[model samples]
Target: MSSAVVGLLIQELPKGGMMMTRTLILGIAATIVAAPSGAFADTPAGNQQAQNTSDAREIVCRRMPPPAGTRIGPRNICRTQAEWDLLQQQNREEVERQQDASHYSRGN
Candidate 1:
């Protein structure tokens, strides 16, 4: 689904409850699938819009850790694909920088 539509649905969900939310979500999904491939456009703007839609639909989730080896309820942390990718790249760069600093300190 497109980000704008999804945002609208999210805003309506609080008042509509689960049944209405589910119905709307399903309808939107159906519409997106049934629409023509060129429904977005052939231009760069359209391509960017399509990419944004795909990114909006992409979700990354990871379970939160339990405390001190005790079995606790599962908690998930989620982010979009773009967000996850940026975070991963930042972490890799930080690690490499640290390694470089360590090597420099060791006179290597």
Candidate 2:
């Protein structure tokens, strides 16, 4: 029954559509095949602290708005969680430094 429906759908699609459908199916199959190995990876009960540290080093991603300019899409930035924290701190310090420089220049 399901095979008949799939056959009908495939017959209706254009030539490129079959390739796209196959690619999608293969991607899903790969994900399902790979998921369980990660779930069952050897993690020692006593290594909770190590796990937490690794979590902090895990890759995090953000989509930042394009810089003030002509037409362009948002940029994707990826960094470790710790790196992101350091970046935020550095930016904050830079802003403060600029503010102090401006204040001093104003003779206040």
For model 2, residues 39-101, the per-residue Cα lDDT tens digits are: 888778779778878988999999999878858989899999989989999999999999888
What's the lDDT for all of these models? 0.79, 0.80
Cand. 2 TM to true fold: 0.48
Query: How far does residue 78 in candidate 2 sit from its true spot (Å)?
Result: 0.9
Residue 66 displacement in candidate 2 (angstroms): 1.0
Q: List the residue pairs that clash in candidate 2.
A: none
lDDT (0-100) at residue 41 of candidate 2? 84
Clashes of each: 0, 0
Q: What does the lDDT read for residue 93 in candidate 2?
A: 100
Per-residue lDDT for 1-108 in model 1, tens only? 776777676766766477777677878777887787667556687788998879866998988776776778778889988888888899999999998888765454
Q: lDDT score, residue 98, model 2?
A: 91
